[model samples]
Target: MKFLIDAQLPVRLSYLLKSMGHDAIHTKELALKNATPDTEINAISIREQRIVITKDSDFWDSFYVNQEPYKLLLVTTGNISNKELESLFIKNLGQVVDLLEQHSLIEMSRDSVIVHQ
Candidate 1:
């Protein structure tokens, strides 16, 4: 799956996704870098058909209100170390991918993954 990692997430997450053999890009790679607005990000997500992976609830709100991004993977794990975050992805990514294939929105907490209607 293709992914557009939001500004709040580390660039390393993009690299991790790439390492897992998916097409992924961090917002830092954008022309506006981390300052890229949510609208532009949503546009990119729609145009590129990339699943937006973010911790930002604004995107969560937009997903329900506007549904412009096409797909979303919300990180609701709260505060955690980068390693812990990466580990969470590593452990649950397979299930996450399967869930995303059928659901427009999926939430990943520290211990479990939730599929949102």
Candidate 2:
């Protein structure tokens, strides 16, 4: 899967995803480095065909209400560190994909990965 990691997500997560053979790009790597407007991110995500991985709920709302072109992974872990985020993704990538394939939105929280179709 192709992924566009949100600014809040550690850039290392993108590297790890790429190492796992998935295409991933950090927000800083995008052209809109200094500007992370919601519409811009959504537009770029759609244009690039990349699933957005973010900690922000706005992206979920944007994709959900707008029925945007790509998928979204909304992380809801509380006060998480970079290592925790990466570990979570590493430990549950397969399950994540399964959820994503079955639903349009996947929310990875402290307790579970919630899926919404």
Q: Report RMSD (Å) for each prediction in the order shown.
A: 0.6, 1.4
Query: Mind giving the per-residue lDDT tens digits that candidate 2 earns over 48-109?
Result: 87888888888877776897638898889978888887788888898998777777788888
lDDT tens per residue, model 1, 1-117? 999999989999999999999999999999999999999999999999999999999999999999868799999988888999899999999999999899999999988899986
For model 1, name the residue pairs that clash: none
RMSD in Å for model 1: 0.6
Candidate 2, residue 89: how far the Cα is off, in Å: 0.8
Task: Compute each candidate's TM-score over C-alphas.
Answer: 0.98, 0.91
What are the per-model numbers of colliding residue pairs? Answer: 0, 0
Please give the lDDT score for candidate 2: 0.83
- Choose the strongest candidate by lDDT: 1
Candidate 2 Cα misplacement greater than 4 A, ranges = none
* Model 1 misplaced regions, further than 4 Å: none
